[model samples]
Target: MMHEPIKGNPLPSRAQAYKTVAVIGAGSWGTALAATLARAGVSTRIWGRDESVIEEINAHHTSEKFLPDVTLPDNLMGVRELSGALAGAEAALIVVPSRSIRSVARQVAEYAPDGMPVAICAKGIEAETGYLMTQVAEEELGNRPVGCVSGPTFAREAALGHLTAATVAFTFSQADRLKPHESPAVRLAVSLSTESFRAYVSDDLVGVEIGGAVKNVIAIACGMMTGAGFAENTRAALITRGLDELKALAEALGGRRETVTGLSGVGDLTLTCSSTTSRNMALGMQLGQGIPRDNCFDGKPVVVEGEVNAKSVTDLARRLNVDMPICETVRAILHDGKGVGDGFAQLWARPIEAEPRAMDLSFDHPASDKDIATLAERIS
Candidate 1:
């Protein structure tokens, strides 16, 4: 069921005023979001490079290549011309591949209306520059408000109108500018939320983006465990420990630790790791089943973001001096041709330490010293 905005707390005139949105990229994720906005009664245009995909979406209200068996909203149109997609768009969503973010942002910069808000829906660190999706957008968009929308969202489920939640992280300034008669942040939040899709606003852009990116790598590790015949106990251990690594990297990158504990963090991690529907997990499953990397993704149009993210995350972790054993192991297996058995053996060979390493809790907590002592005693 779609959630109605709080009854008495109606949105201001301007907050409820947006009429159209442009979605760049015609992949499953992009199409799903476009369908969502169109269902919300907003005119949505999706830009795709392929003429066939555009024709399929326009003529049949479906993108069979990316989102099969799903009927899109009639209000949703697909455009082959980038300029046409952005011509009258009130806001834009960039849903391209991580590496293509810069080029797409440059196009939006040239074609989009001045000062239009852009939300990045892609999640990954740039392999060459280590830039997060929003960072790349800001660099190329030049003063345009760039935010991020991320969580544990599967395109198929979202397109089917299943309940979904996502975090929208934007700067205070961006939030302020987006506001009309009320709180800008709240107004921006209202603009994005739909009956079935809920948007939570946060200022921790780095944490949200990091969680979305790094969880794919961890999901691959969990898939490897599944393929190796490890039980749920092993998967549980990886999820817990992987979260610790996620928190460490988020903090090192100047994000609040609590952000990793939210929807975009543990929520996304759990979904991706536990589901074979995840492209990354499926790719890892192939590797675990002894399939070569080249053969793993044969004839697939969707990108398995984790395969590239493994290298990027490991590189970022090293640059920040954060310990990420699992991510590093994934990097070795994917990029260095390390055997799966050897990778797990290497991880098991490492010396044991405190469950939550002391360094992992470097961030100051709100608990009183007495509270900490009580918690410690309970654990002991």
Candidate 2:
């Protein structure tokens, strides 16, 4: 049942939509998604291990622990038991932190009804395996159709009914893979989209997920620059170069370059790097303000994804032979305990190169006076 307003655009009717969607986390993102889904008229149930948060959502339609200022939808139900959340749900959206996703996926595998489509909304590479979130979901939830929901979304803003867009990417040929059945991508996308929340569908699942993961790491670098009093030009340079790195990594991982230029790529990158509301960027700001790594967290209760993404992104880049200096430098500062100033210095000291469509040209431009002098000193 496709609702085609135009020849190419297909929309799903209310009768075709999934009646119940199980949101597998109670954190900010999860709550926001649950609220959005409920507002869109879908029956949504949010699951969390914290019984208190569940009670709060059920009784007051608020999630103070995560979204302190926002009130959730009245119809959005909260459940503590995994089985109860998944009992009659047609889809499950995993919004837990990446570190805990595998465990959650394991639970879903055991509890979720067979053939329910799973969408991963969290954005980060798995630290232990360096696998993308979609890959992790696919591995853990064997034979199930997997998809990704990611973009430049902030939980608070989206919860406030602000205009937002995201990429809804499912694996290509999913119907064929499922064999003798309909693919959930279109139905899921239509069901998730609303007046304020728009969903752009694609098949480049890897590229979309890559943009979500790498942008967090880049946002940290941009935050550090801001914290250190760097001007806008420096931030722009970093953002542009970060795009190059993202494209390189995406291509290496078999994703399309155009995907890196889409909403999930440049759009998400710009929003994350420019805003302090992002947890990763905020963490970078603290580090850039000369705060010790140990003291950066102080009182924040959030899991800053960039902290873990730095290591996983850099490791994956190295394994794929992709050049991502900004991400590498972030990993050094965050994991190697390298000083921020020194890291920036090393980044600025690298030789300049020409840009191309692929940005892969390795030829260095004319050597700087400093380089020439250093070379001369070595020769002498």
Candidate 3:
């Protein structure tokens, strides 16, 4: 489905939303988003299995382990029980690790209010099933409305209330859209946005999810370049070529190519690849510095999603017959026991070709200016 603009009532003021939201993880990203919602006057509850973390959040209003030095809002609380978190939530955001998405979503489907919109904030392909985050959500969450929230967000910066914009992709069922009810997509966008956090709504769920998943693998490659003391030009080339790989895979999976050029695709890719704060990039950096894979994430509390996603994406590309050399190289370095240097050598050994059109190319004839204008009008 195409990403049509959200059409419905103009959202009420932030103070008037009066929403209570459930965030299904107490990790850095989940906590940060919970804080954002609470600061926007929405009552927010974060769920976690760790009692100590829940206690710290409720009593001290801080997540010292994941987001140290960040103060949470008064209205943001933490719950040890998932049921307690979902009891009165108008919506739920699944922010757990990508690998745990299916399990968490099943629990949410069991407890969350009927018809509650669930926003998937996690970003990775399931290593075991190769399912995108949204696909997993759909399989486990049943008929619940599903959306994806992703972009160039750093948890610390977002918690600090720095201006951040993210792509929010949701689609209404045809039956729901034909009814007299307001657009759930619009409502989700309004409920999730804060003064400093903006959401650009889209209907390209596949593109949004693919962008969020594949960028991590590319970030690992970029980090390897950085750790190997490569110049900025090399990093820039990787970023560009990495985007090409992303576009190709996303399109092959039935996603719109233009969606990849949006916030969830190039935007997230640039952020993850350019920063040491990205856990995936950091993992790659450690590998480049001669650290073994087992020891790379030794003291880190957070999961390095790219390490697992590297193998998943490579598998997916192979299944789809998509060319993703960067992701393949990442998979080799992380999973195939290939040395970082050797992986780079393999990538450099590939033959060159003209840049392939990553968008849909089923047209049989060239288009005139009038045809181009008509196409633009239709898309616009």
> Highest lDDT: which candidate?
2
| Whole-model lDDT per candidate | 0.83, 0.85, 0.82
TM-score list, all predictions:
0.87, 0.90, 0.87
Q: Residue-wise lDDT of candidate 1 within 82-126, one digit each (tens)?
A: 999999887888998888999999999999988788889999999
| lDDT tens per residue, model 3, 1-380 | 44343477443333234378889999899999888888877788899888899999999999899899999988888898999999988888899888888988988888988878899999888877778898899899887888889999999999998999888788756653443134555555666678899977677888898999899999999888777767688689888999998888888888888989999999999999999899878887777777776777775565788888898888888989988989998888788877777677556545545565534433333545565455433322
Q: How many clashes does the backbone of model 2 have?
A: 0
What is the TM-score (0 to 1) of candidate 1?
0.87
1-380 per-residue lDDT for model 2 (tens digits): 12223455353433256789999999899999889999989999999989999999999989888899897888999998999999988998998999888889989999888888999998989888889998998888987888989888999899988999988888757343333124577667777888899878777888999999999999999988788877699889999999999999999988988889999999999999998888888888888887776677786566888889999999999998888999999999888977787687667667676677446555554667576556433322
lDDT of 3: 0.82
Residue 129 lDDT, candidate 1, scale 0-100: 88
Off by over 4 Å in 1: 1-14, 174-188, 298-302, 359-380
